[model samples]
Target: MIKKLLLTFSFLAVSMLLAQKNNDQQTVDEASEKLRLAMISGDKTVLESLILPELTYGHSGGHIDDAKEFVEKLVSKKSNFLTIENTNQSIQIVDKTAIVRNHLFAQTHDFGKEQGEVSLDILYVWQKTKNGWKLLARQAVKAEKKK
Candidate 1:
């Protein structure tokens, strides 16, 4: 009888852990979607809310931008995103941090430049704060074309 109870408790504990992981994954997914929309919309308020004060945004061309510069570029339409699509996304949660990887394809219309399309593989690090998940860092590399 004791053996059966121990097995039952172990099973319940494992089930509960899986449930919580799923919930966290869903929440992170929603946050990612919100970020995608905000980027395309260029809404400064939403962008500010999602990004941390110490963000490190790395571009494919090897330029890096701090949180303020990143926000300012987007808000000023200097890095305007007309459309963004994220694919093959996977998020791994470790403690309070989430590591996300995905393929990003976007149509951009920067100020004083012609519209262009970009394809890149992006890595994003997000931290769970009291206010929710905020972006801590991001890096992008140009995506390789399939042969």
Candidate 2:
């Protein structure tokens, strides 16, 4: 009887842990989608809420921006995103941090320039804070062309 009780408790504990991980994954995915929409919308409030104060945003062109600069560019339409599509996304959570990778295809018009399309592979780092998950850092590289 005691052995059965111990086995049941162990199983329950493992199940609970798995459930928590799944919940975290779903939350992170939602946060990521919100960020994508915010980028396209250029909503200052939403962008500010999703980004940490000390963000490090890297572009495929090798440029980098801090949180303030990033937000300013979008708000000012200096980096206007007409449309953003994310594909093949994967998220991994390690403790309080989550790592996300995705392929980004976007139509953009920057600094009132002509529209262009970009294909990039992006890496985003998010931290789980008191205000839920906020973007910590991001880096992007040009996607390799398929033959």
**lDDT values for all models:** 0.93, 0.93
Query: Once all C-alphas are superposed, what RMSD does model 1 give against the true structure?
Result: 1.7
| For every candidate, C-alpha RMSD to the true structure in Å | 1.7, 1.5
User: How would you encode candidate 2's per-residue C-alpha lDDT over 1-147 as one tens digit per residue?
Assistant: 999999999999999998988998999999999999999988999999999999999999999999999999998989999999899999999999999999999999998699988899999999999999999999999996422
Model 1, C-alpha of 33: deviation from truth (Å): 0.6
Cα lDDT tens digits, model 1, 39-63, are 8888999999999999999999999
TM values, all candidates:
0.93, 0.94
Error of 1 at 116 (Å): 0.7
